[model samples]
Target chain A: MKKSILITGGARSGKSALAERLALSRSGRAVYIATAEARDDEMRDRIAQHRARRGAGWTDHEAPLDLVGTLDATDGDAPRLVDCLTLWLTNLMLSGADWRAAGTALAEALPRQTAPVVLVTNEVGSGIVPDNRLAREFRDAAGWLNQTIATACDEVYLSVAGCPLKVKPDDVSL
Target chain B: MKKSILITGGARSGKSALAERLALSRSGRAVYIATAEARDDEMRDRIAQHRARRGAGWTDHEAPLDLVGTLDATDGDAPRLVDCLTLWLTNLMLSGADWRAAGTALAEALPRQTAPVVLVTNEVGSGIVPDNRLAREFRDAAGWLNQTIATACDEVYLSVAGCPLKVKPDDVSL
Candidate 1:
């Protein structure tokens, strides 16, 4: 069976970079599933930077809100790397999409894929509680999303300071 | 030799709870050094909740600032759990204290302690980049602080969804 790996860490903790590296390590074609939308200049710049970093050799798919559908459509032979889930959550919240339904769809769709999948998610629960309601809601939703996705994954890694620590399978040799 | 353990996680990922549990697991007195200040009703209620949760067998020390002095004065035989370093960072930022210097002081003081210490900290770098400079600065400072403290500590665990993942001593069995 193809394996699903989840990589989580704080901002700029080299999570996405690690995910990219993992995707490249696998055989066959690589697919990059980008969940970020270029809503502003900063975001646009960040997306551009990511594109530059990934270089050539990977297919890019922008599915800010249609993650399940995109994953369903990808070729089974190609390994898929979902760069992040937090921004997808933000997009869902902003678009007024039902989080539970989207999360359910993601959970149900993941196992159906034939290709190996590597997911990158932000571990946002270790910080101070946000002062605003929206931020708090996002934090809670993100936490739920991470837990749900992590449960479905065959391997989970918590990235810190550019190091990847295998979290799941609890006894796996790193 | 006394051991210093650093526990890091996102907002409500059970980092503090795990630290508290660790403190309770050890023999001797448990000292909880709280860094939060009850500046508002919300904060006061949160503090009250923590107090109620800890309940009875622990010594509480409120040190929004002067963490070094408080640690210096604590009984050497008791286990000390600083149920977070992030808020202390906020307090320092608000009070115009030098974060680098304070972090250096903490790094220096932790090794000299006689009692086993468990420090809870937020892994704030994994989220979306804050839109403002101050928040960005805080994120960078917090990351640096975690790295510095983790370097000095004997053990490091990254908490997530109430589960503790041992990160340091890479070969130790979890």
Candidate 2:
């Protein structure tokens, strides 16, 4: 039962809610891994909203950078939900860490987990090309990251307007 | 039979390629309704690249604004492929036109089409929210448009790395 699922969508596309549902579906209790840091008021508000929605039946862990370590340590009977990989990448990028290597390591680490790991990410490359070079570079990296992680996962889905559309392990080829 | 399809994804996610395949899947020759206007060298180059990839059997039509009318005009023997809806929306917004009204009109016009129509659009809302107000507004409009068009379409797909995953007319809820 290696239920390694990657859920990706736009901002406010209901990815976290869906991930929460899947994480708690099999087991009433699950582990919540927060990759986001509340550095500002906006970030704090978002984090609070997510926390409020997730309510109970969840043990939370803050793993902004050391996601692999968090996953390895949390390996047990309870399923783990990484609310996002994008923020983890952002943290790595901002800290001058090798994000490519980090992303690869996470993909490599997915298969060995004893507990179900439901990861979430954002789709940032589909819009018009950004005017700034950094935004362009970030979007490019995000797209590549999504493709790499998707290749390693057991299942992948793209959420739209709060609806999940399974993409990987699907019959249709792109 | 009416076969209106909406194809959406991020940049270089293989949206246009998938739209072309679907457009020609039923008819050997299909009308290419491009909403893009070659106002500059970059845009011209991109348009040329698309044209080169499409190769033969495509009758090109430029309707940067009047897409609903273009669809009606091209409803004859060949199926029509609107290379994008996002660009059309951009044109409308830039011109200070009521894009919401136009988007709704396009959706309403889809059901009355006698010929098959394959509309391509971008998924712009999946990324980090833009820092600028205009980009934010555009992404919001694009997301609303995608959902609206999808509601009217017989099929809706999200392209990923050159693969097509059907989202509409499927049993998978959400």
Candidate 3:
């Protein structure tokens, strides 16, 4: 049976770094699933920086949409790290994709995968209520998506100031 | 020595409720400190809703800018629950208050207070980098404030979907 880890934190909270560390800890071919699209210069630069930081040992897969499909296409034996669910949510929302359906599909597919998977997501619901409708909707959807993914994962961790705090496996000593 | 508790979470993540619950659990008078200023109808409604939810058994104190002064004026024996630090930060920013200086003052005052303090603060750093400079600045300031308060508090909790996960006292069993 494969293990699924959900790592959630704020921007620059070291969530992706933690996920990468976890993925590297596993013994197998590691694949980095990039959910962000370089839609603008800053985003493009961010993508470049992430790529440069990862350096040399992993296979990269881009899945701005059809995340479930991309995961399905990857070799089952390879350990996979999905860089983020937040960006994927944004992609879905911007592209007019059915977020609910996409979320459901991803949830269903996660358990069926043969490889150990580490997912990184942002915990965006802890901020002030956004004044704009789009931001508010995004926050709600992200929160719901996070809760759904967390429920499906074997272990869940919330990162703060680069520290990973185990939230799942609730019985485990903190 | 009086205890200080920091409750941090996303918007609608139940940080305030958790803070209130903790304050009520304590054996003493409870004072509610609200930092939000109703500049618009929607904000007014929100303030009204929060006020309605927290009815009776509590004295309400409004401190949009003078948080430290207001806190000082309150009865020192009463356990005070500050509804949030995010709004207070907003108030400070809008009023051109020096956030760094204000934060330092807060840090200094919290320890000297005789009353137990339960603070609610939003974790705004967990989301995507905001597009505008002001929003980005706000996120950074909020993050810094949270970290500062968390360090000072005897207990710090990160709430997610209404679940309170203890972050401070790093070694104790949860």
Candidate 4:
């Protein structure tokens, strides 16, 4: 059976760990799709931490901002873990690719996947209003991206303070 | 009078033209906040086209994702044009910056801008639904960003195929 789940939460809320753990629950050659760019020490540390936690024997793919192409390149029923969508969108936006082209590329690519997918993203909507125009734009985009992914996934989870709350059922009998 | 307007549209839909035209209407200086990263020849051409149009006497600042800093750095009552937000957001995401932190920063910075700000962005929500996980996320983020900017701006315009339509009114009184 084809299964897809979306995992999201606040920063340092353990969303990535939880998504990886969930992907490991099923037995297969799990693939990790990392979208983050190591632009600083802190980010490098975070990426290292995720890498260390995942350990060996996992196929790691660093396809920043090209999720659709990466998804299409992979072969098998193995569970695919897209580390996060927030950074992926960021990469695309910075590369001068309009949001619609990115979205169209992404929306058109999801249905062709032959494996169960687990996607991770940041939950940023519930917060104080941003101060600058660009920040507000990011918040709006992140919120909208989360909603779109949640709508497409069969199950959705909200992680806060390292705790996971299932917003959708994981019933396999359906 | 300090006037701020956010311009949004699809790719190559004359957003830059509208933004430059709007910025020229004001005094002080015209500051261009460019968010694009020239990844290829096409992007280079696009950026060149915009730069060529701006002509001489325009100070160009490349603030890919640091909107707050850009806004803060500019001294009083100057006319500023943020060429686009879509690319800026992508830069932030790829750089591993927390979406909320970045959003908060931008939101806080806009109101303090002394210039009549003309912000440009792409409207990506009207397109076909995203099929893949990554594209869907981008679509959602772009939609939210537009909504947030429209809400924050005194005036908003939606550009389609090089034609401009006023979606919001100018709040600055002469």
Candidate 5:
């Protein structure tokens, strides 16, 4: 089992479910770290749905901004699964925090984790180029963040229609 | 080499380049089918850049709507690479055409083609839910279309940062 794993895909592509499966694969009692903020009804509903879907055998933690610190605090006995990175990036950008430096710090922190960590992220740049500058910038940042974490992780997979497709370690002869 | 290949990825994620390489691998010449319309300066510049990057040894055909007809017309002596399906879907939707039927027709048309068909598509549904209904619908359609065509293809590869990672007929142990 890899110490660090990054799972990325488009929305509803089964990333969280796959991450849950992987998180609990090694140990049944893994931590579910959420980065999303329930700022709206839709977001609140989404958070609730995720919590409901991810039932039992898990401890919940919300780290809308302090993800690295949260990981540090939860690195004891259970493997930690960060539900996402894009939301964390969004929070940082919205708050005018240094997302790039935070990304680097998170990558630097992953290698030193005493417990295994599985992070989830989205593939936001695959669509038509956004007509808005902010959307464009956010997508670019998300893409860069995904690649950075992917590069630093021990394993990387792209989930498609609920199936895990390994992207890192280049097993395919493509 | 598979007769049909679907290479999907994000914007600037190296999908076109990978498709170009696959298009030229078996034979030196291939048909470059363009689904994008140069509606604005941004689009015009993007089309021009794609043309410049995919230099010599290719015949170009512009089919913003009549993709199937064009594919049928040019399925001789060389492989056909549809630059993208999402744009074609957009054209279809904008023109009030039935995209679902079009997608089904496309899936059926792939196995029947005498020459190989390499299709490129975007992953649009992986990001945070769009604020607009139309964007949401478009992303859902794009995602469904990708999965539909991917299921029909002989091979599917996800280009991440310009490197082709085999996805369809997945060889990964994960």
Candidate 6:
């Protein structure tokens, strides 16, 4: 049976780093899927820092929101780490896909994989509400995405200020 | 100034017909963004029909793929057509969204004001896809979404047999 883990938190909340640490502890090669698009200088710096942190022990895959394809491509001996799903969803929504179309796609794609997938995402809904319609739409999507992946995962963890709290997918459930 | 036209086609070859006829008479839209998620036998038939007949009105909106937000959602009265972008980008590839927080957000938000937006989307793209992985992904995203809005439209027409003959749209782009 295929197993998966979903890690979620807000920006600068150490979600990615926590996911990486968990992935490294697993007994297999680590595959990292980076989803953020460096559209500006700040993002560029962020991406660089992430790359440096990984430190050559990873095979990095660059797919903005094409997770299914990325997962398919990395189907081998490894514990797959999807650095983030929030940015990936943003890429897809901005790509002109309706939420229904986007949501069903991800939900259906998860069950077909054999490798253990560890996903990371931001908790955007934990703060102030967005004023624009699009931002609100994106926020809603992010929450739904976290729920969808969490349901499919063997473990679900939420990080806050650098601590990990297990939510679902208990050993008994597995 | 950049111009766009939205095309609505069917399984055999209806969408292109409508799109082409409409494009032949431009109505001053921004750019044509396709939003179909091709995933099944029906979708394959529809995509084949569209590819065989596509001409003129195909402008690439590669980035910010979501037509509703990426384009200028204005508060004025200028006609714009996002020809068949809904079907072209299909939702299978889409991944992040929360619909409860933004249910029918596009319908509520897009048609709210004076901007004349003509969107063309296939009534299909959701259903069975003969067990093919990628094809199934596509069909799951496309459904009767476009047909729902055709009723609210000032003019709606269906194409049967190959013909660009049936023409409809309020403001011509000539």
The candidate maximizing DockQ is: 2
List of chain A TM-scores, every candidate = 0.94, 0.97, 0.94, 0.89, 0.97, 0.89
Model 2 interface CAPRI class: incorrect
Candidate 2, pairs of clashing residues: A10-B126, A126-B10, A126-B11, A163-B174, A164-B174, A174-B162, A174-B163, A174-B164
How do all models score by TM-score?
0.60, 0.61, 0.60, 0.48, 0.61, 0.48
The fnat score for candidate 2 comes to 0.36
In order, candidate lDDTs are 0.83, 0.87, 0.81, 0.72, 0.87, 0.57
Indicate the DockQ of the complex predicted as candidate 5.
0.22
Per-residue lDDT value at A61 in model 6: 88
- Pairs in steric clash, model 3: A10-B126, A125-B10, A125-B11, A126-B9, A126-B10, A126-B11, A127-B10, A127-B11
DockQ of every model listed?
A: 0.18, 0.23, 0.20, 0.02, 0.22, 0.01
DockQ of 1: 0.18
- What DockQ number belongs to candidate 6? 0.01
Residues B1-174, candidate 2: write the lDDT tens digits: 347999888876678877888788775789999999999876897799899999899999999999999999889868899988999999999989999999999999999888899999988875566888989988989989999999999988877744578777788666
Instruction: Name the candidate, 1 or 4, with the larger lDDT value.
Output: 1
What TM-score between 0 and 1 does chain B of candidate 4 receive? 0.89
In the range B1-174, model 5's lDDT, one tens digit per residue, is 679999998965668877888888887889999999999986798799899989999999999988889999999969899989989999999999999999988988888899999999987765667788899889888888999999999999887744468767865687
The runs of at least 3 residues in candidate 5 whose Cα sits more than 4 Å from the true structure, single-residue gaps closed, are A1-122, A126-131, A137-165, B171-174
Model 2 whole-model lDDT (C-alpha atoms): 0.87
lDDT at residue A129 of model 5 (Cα atoms): 61
Off by over 4 Å in 3: A171-174, B1-8, B12-156, B161-163, B168-174
The residue-by-residue lDDT of candidate 4 on A37-120, one tens digit each, is 899999999899989988865898997877888888874878889988889878877887786567556655666677888888
Task: Write the residue-wise lDDT of candidate 5 on A1-174 in tens digits.
Answer: 789999888789999999999999986779999999889999999999988988899998999999999999999968999989989999999999999999999999999899999999987786656878788878878877887787789888888899997877776553
Model 5: lDDT to the true structure: 0.87
Q: Give the DockQ-based CAPRI class for model 1.
A: incorrect
Q: Per the 3 Å backbone cut-off, how many clashing residue pairs does candidate 2 have?
A: 8
Query: How do the residues B1-174 of candidate 4 rate in per-residue lDDT, one tens digit apiece?
Result: 336688886544457876887787656358887889898775697699778878865888888777778878874666888878877777777887775567656655667666678888876654345456666676666667766767767777764323355656634577
lDDT of 6 at A37: 85
